[model samples]
Target: MIDALYVAETGLQAGQKHIDTISNNMANLNTTAYKKGRIEFRDLVVGREVTSLDETGKRDLVSIGNGTQISRVWKEFQSGDLKATENPLDLAIRGGGFFEVLLENGEVAYTRNGAMKVDEDGYLGTLTGYRFSDMIQIPPDAKELEISQDGTVTAYFDNDSLEIGQIQLAGFMNAQGLDSIGQGIYVANDESGNAIYSDAGENGIGILQQGYLESSNVDLVKELVELVTAQRGYQACSHVIRAADEIMQITNDLRG
Candidate 1:
């Protein structure tokens, strides 16, 4: 009975984590370029022992499983739907890649959110003020700003077109291994490999789409189903715990 209680406790903890992950995915359903989270579970085996010898004199091994635990929680990197905003500054990647941004701490960060804006210094940056790593700057008097599929920036002034700096993208060997630091930003780690900088639409990188933004990749229906499953699992574990306690109480009353 004591072992049953412990096992059910583990189940409750794992089920709660699963539900939390599902809730987080649903909460970010409307976020720009948001990736959904996936939870993995592993069976917890407490011990293994030889129970007895078979008729052929072979040992029979019995493995005891305590419960289940959360093995990992990884982000799904599938591309989301592209939404057209009709704003030239809004950009979206059509394939695999991430936008490179220069943080205030002089470190490079990666993101899929492409809602960009011009800073006070005419430098192109995210709405939250993270400057583009390429340092592409727009002229103060420029008009008709346009970014081509190849990430070539251009503007017209005095009926003449001027070329701005090109926007570059970064790729990773294991993008799922990147560490997410919120705000749709990620940082490279050892498991993620180093950032591979490339020109847009080159070297397997994605092409940039001006006047568009990437929507969050969360699927509402899938999350709702997962939430239901997790809730049932939690309830089942609670029942197991309750049953173990009641049986223990009955035994104690009979002894008295």
Candidate 2:
């Protein structure tokens, strides 16, 4: 009876975790450059619940069934579609990759937000005004600017001439192992492996676009379906608990 209770409780806890994941995905439905998370679970016998004291690994034979456990929850970095807003500074990646932004903490943060802008000092920056790895200085006196899909930055001055620079993108050997630092920023980890530096549209890093933003990939309908499924599963586990309690009550009555 106790073991049955434990099984029901474990199942309920795991289902709650599943519900939590769904909730978070729904909450980030409008977050820019947002990625979805997935939950993984497993089961195995944790210990000897049967009372056969083998105190030694040498004596009684005890068989135990598998119990529940959550293995790992990981993030999916699949690219969302690029939305054209016609904003001069908005940018997006047409394929696989992330934008490199320098953080104030002397760390580099990666994102998918391509909405960029130039500040008063002619420094190239994200929509939030965080400068890219290298500050791209345009002459305040420049007449026009053009950024190529290949991440080449060119500025046309009053002399009808253009100067060029390269925007850098960071690639991790194991991007799945990277950590989300919130606000669409991702920080690398040792498990994420070292960043493999590369140019846009090279080595599978993806091309850049100007005047566009990536849309959130979350589909509310799909998530709602999943949420309904999780709720049903939790209810099923609760049913198990209720059934077990009824059986326990009957046993007590018989004892009387």
Candidate 3:
């Protein structure tokens, strides 16, 4: 009966976690460079003893019972598709790489968002006006803008003046080690290792597409399927707990 109660509790908790992930993905369906998350469950029914004593003096061996635990939430790094919107400032990656942007705090951060806009200072930046690491300044009289697959930024001015800039993309050894800073920005950590330099469209890094934006990688159909499975698992666990309770009640009535 006790085991049944613990199982039911863990199952309900896991179901709640799944719901949280689903809601988060749905909320970010329209967010650029958004990655979906998945829940992992680990069965930890045994616990090891932390302390040891003299074998003859005392028995320190202990195995405390534990139930299901949320192992970890994993993020999918699959690249999102690029959709052209005719916006010259828009950028998208065709592979697995991130754009380096300068946050308001003057720190260099990474992002996958390509729906960028220039600020009043003529600085090419995100919609939030945060500057990009490699500023691709457009001439005041520029009329045409183009970005090559190799991260080359070209601007054609009215007077035949052209300016070119190259934006470098960065990747990490362990992408999961990067911490999300909201708005699709990420800060690298020890687990993430250092950013590996790579030319766009070369190697495994993704190519850059000008006038395009990357959509969120979340798949609604996949999330729905997981939601249903979680719900059913919760129901099954509840049934087990209910049956155990019924048996316990009958035993008690017979004893009375």
Candidate 4:
């Protein structure tokens, strides 16, 4: 009964984590370029002491799986739906690549959010104000801005156009290993490897689509179904714990 109680407690914990991940995904369904999170679980095993002696007086070690635990929470890198905003500054990636941005602390971060804004200094940046690290600046008095599929930036003024700067996309050996730093920014970790710079449409990188933005990849129906499963699993674990407690109570009553 004690072991059952402990196992049920672990189950409850795992179920709670699962539900939390699902809730986060659902909440970010409308977030621009938002990637969904997933929780992985592993079984916890308990083993007998190696020095323990069996009935035959010989040392024996036995292993038994006790319960489950959350192994990891990973992000899904699948592309989201591309939405047409008709805004000239809006951009969408048609393949795999992340936009490079410079953080306040001068650290580099990556994102898939392409909703951009031009600052007073003619600096191009994300809607949240993270400027492009590559110094892609727009010129003042430019009547129009154009971003080519290859990420070349062109400014048009008085029926004349000039190439200013180019936006470079960064690719990773393992994009899933990137750490989410909130606000659609991700920093590369050891597991994610180093960021590989490439032209937007070159070297397996994705092309940029002007006047579009990428939508969150979260699937509402799938998340709702998973939410139901997590809730049921939690309830079942609770029932197990209650049953174990009742068994102990019954034993005490019988002794009395």
Candidate 5:
């Protein structure tokens, strides 16, 4: 009876985790270049045959099955839809790539978000203030900025255009392994492999589309269906717990 209760508890926990993941995805539906998260589960088994030696030498065997557990939570890196924003500073990639951003701690992070803006210091950066990893700077007096599909940055000033610098994209062997820090940013870890820098349209990187941004890849309909399933699963687990408790109570009452 107690084992049944434990199994049900595990089921309840797993259901809750699934619901939480879906909830987060729904919350970020409108976030630029946002990727959805998924949860994986593993089964747990308890009770197995074990040999024990008594003072007089003895052998014993036992077998037990526990329940399920959450094995991993990973993000799906499927490319999101690119929408035209008509903003010169907005950018989007149509393939597998991420923009490299330099963090305040001198470390670097990666993101698919391309909503960039130039600051008073002539440094181009993301809305969150993280500058591009490369030294792509703009002139203080530049009237227009253009980023080519190949990542060439051009500045127009006084009826003249000049190439400033080039923006680069980073790729990973296992992007799903990257650690997500909020705000649609991720940091590479050993599991994700080191960052591979390349031109936007070179080395398997994606082509850049100026005046556009990537929309979150979350599918609202699918998430809503999954949310409902998770809720039902949670309720079923609770029912199991109730049944187990009733059995335990009946067993206790028999001793009266």
Candidate 6:
């Protein structure tokens, strides 16, 4: 009976964690370039015993399972839908890649959010003011700007056009291993490997789409279904705990 209580407790914890993950995913449904999170669980075994010997002298074993535990939580890196915008600075990736931005602390962070803006100094950066790693600057007198699918940046002044710079993309071996720092930004770690920098559309990198932004990859219907399942699981665990308590109470009454 005590073991039943411990097992149900583990189940309750697992269900709560699952619900939390679903909630987070739903909350970021409208965030730009947001990736949904996934949770994994593993079964816990408390004990193992040899029950009997078979005809071939092999021992028959019985394993006692404790409960389930959270194994890992990872981000799904699948591409989100691209949304068209009138702003030329807005960009979207058609495949696998991430935009590199220099943070305030001088550390380079990777993101899929491509809603960019020009600063007062004519320097192009993200909407959050994180400058591009390469620091592409536009001339003050530039009348128009254009970005090609291959990430070539050009500025038009009257009838003449000048190539200013090129936008580069960074990729990782295991993007799911990247650590998210909120606001659609991620940082690379040992598990994610190093960032592989390259031109857009080159070396398996994704092509750039000017005037478009990537929408959040969260599926509302899926999250709602998961929420329902997690709630039911939590309720089932609660019932198990209550039953265990009642069994203990009955045993005490009999003894009395």
User: lDDT by residue for model 2 over 1-256, one digit each (tens)?
Assistant: 7788888898899999999999999999987777888888887565554555565755554557555767877788888777888876677888877777888876787888777888777788877767788677877777777778888888888677666587877787778888887777788888887677778989988888887788877878989999999899899989989999999999999999
TM-score of 1: 0.93
Regions of candidate 5 where Cα sits further than 4 Å from its true position = 50-63
Global CA lDDT computed for model 3: 0.82
All candidates: TM-score: 0.93, 0.86, 0.85, 0.95, 0.94, 0.92
**lDDT agreement with native, every candidate:** 0.93, 0.80, 0.82, 0.94, 0.92, 0.94
lDDT of candidate 4? 0.94
Q: Extract clashing residue pairs from model 2.
A: 90-211, 90-212, 91-114
Colliding pairs, model 6: none
Pull out the clashing pairs in model 4: none
Per residue, candidate 1 scores C-alpha lDDT tens digits across 173-194 of 9999999988999999998999
- Higher TM-score: candidate 2 or 5? 5
Summing lDDT over every window of 10 consecutive residues in candidate 5, give the lowest-scoring window.
Answer: 54-63
At residue 210, give the lDDT of candidate 6: 95
RMSD in angstroms between candidate 1 and the native structure over all alpha carbons? 2.1
Question: What is the C-alpha lDDT profile of model 6 across 112-157, one tens digit per residue?
Answer: 9999999998888999889999789999999999999999999999
Provide the clashing-pair count of each candidate structure.
Answer: 0, 3, 1, 0, 5, 0
Poorly placed runs, candidate 2 (over 4 Å):
47-63, 119-121
lDDT of 5 by residue, 77-148 (tens): 999999998999999998999999999999999999999988668798999999998868898888999999
Model 1 CA deviation exceeding 4 Å by range:
48-62
After superposing candidate 3 on the true structure, give the runs of residues whose Cα lies further than 4 Å from its correct spot. 47-65
Ranking by TM-score: 4, 5, 1, 6, 2, 3
